[model samples]
Target: MTIAPSDSALAPALRGYADHKPDHLARLHKIEGQVRGLTRMVDDDRYCIDVLTQITAATHALQEVALGLLDDHIRHCVQEAVRADQDTGETKYAELTIALRRALRL
Candidate 1:
């Protein structure tokens, strides 16, 4: 199969999630608050361990968001694309493997 630089079919199809953007925004806002709290902890001369703990929590929160987004992509974007064209299963599988590798690196 010819590997195009872009998945034109999936790109347009995946943009149909306008119904639940508020949920994503809410998660982002929570993460934002966590970051702000971390900043304040540093500014207030909090203990090193306390600051590190908050940092870990914020990192985990970010990871959770990333995982959620990835799951959505797999369930919706990749699922639809593969269903639309059965031959794309290999290409989509490769893409998921690459994404999983990057996530693992973090």
Candidate 2:
């Protein structure tokens, strides 16, 4: 099957994914606030363990956001590629593998 990059079939789904930007930004804002709180915790000489725990929670929250985006990309872009009878699954898999490796620092 010949694949054309200009596939209109995927546009709507991609747009839907783009529409998620604002919500993602809002989540980042909250995460930013958590970071600021963490800074203050350090300045106030809060318990070391408590500060560490907050850092862990913040890391997890950020990971959750990243995972959400990855899932959306797979559902939209990757799925569209597959339906287009292109080797989109393998392409997306490789892209995601690289992304995961970078994000996880592995």
Candidate 3:
């Protein structure tokens, strides 16, 4: 089961996010530049295939960031939860499982 962000008591779990804030910011900045380049490509009437190739590269880069964040969450947050207790730890594990499923689009 998925807990909606607005409904959850947990205040936006971002353990991994906080840990990698600088890295994420840097990657996002690069992605922003790529987006600007894509916009310029469109505005300058570049070839459709070239623009699409850029788009694909940008998407893959974003996915890499996402996977890294997810890994950190599992290694830090989820691991802590499981180590802390059994009952609620199980819940945390379930929560992480759901997250992994969603991340993997399973």
Report lDDT (CA) for all predictions: 0.78, 0.77, 0.81
**Which segments of candidate 3 are over 4 A away from where they belong?**
2-14
Clash number by candidate, in order: 0, 0, 0
Whichever of 1 and 2 has more lDDT, that candidate is 1
Candidate ranking (lDDT, best to worst): 3, 1, 2
What TM-score would every model get versus the actual structure?
0.80, 0.73, 0.80
lDDT of 1 by residue, 33-62 (tens): 999999999999999999999999989988
Regions of model 2 farther than 4 Å from truth: 1-16, 103-106
Q: Write candidate 3's Cα lDDT for 41-98 as tens digits.
A: 9999999999999999899889888888888878877787788898656777777778
Residue 70 CA displacement from its true place in model 1, Å? 1.1
**Candidate 1 vs. true structure, TM-score:** 0.80
Winner on lDDT (2 vs 3): 3
Best to worst by TM-score, what's the order? 3, 1, 2
Q: For residues 1-106, what per-residue lDDT tens digits would candidate 2 score against the true structure?
A: 2334444665564442585788778888999999999999999999999999999988988987888788777777778767876566766566766767777871
lDDT pick, better of 1 and 3: 3
> What root-mean-square deviation over C-alphas does model 2 reach?
5.5
Query: Could you tell me which residue pairs clash in candidate 3?
Result: none
Tell me how far the alpha carbon of residue 39 in candidate 2 is from the true structure, in angstroms, after superposition. Answer: 0.8
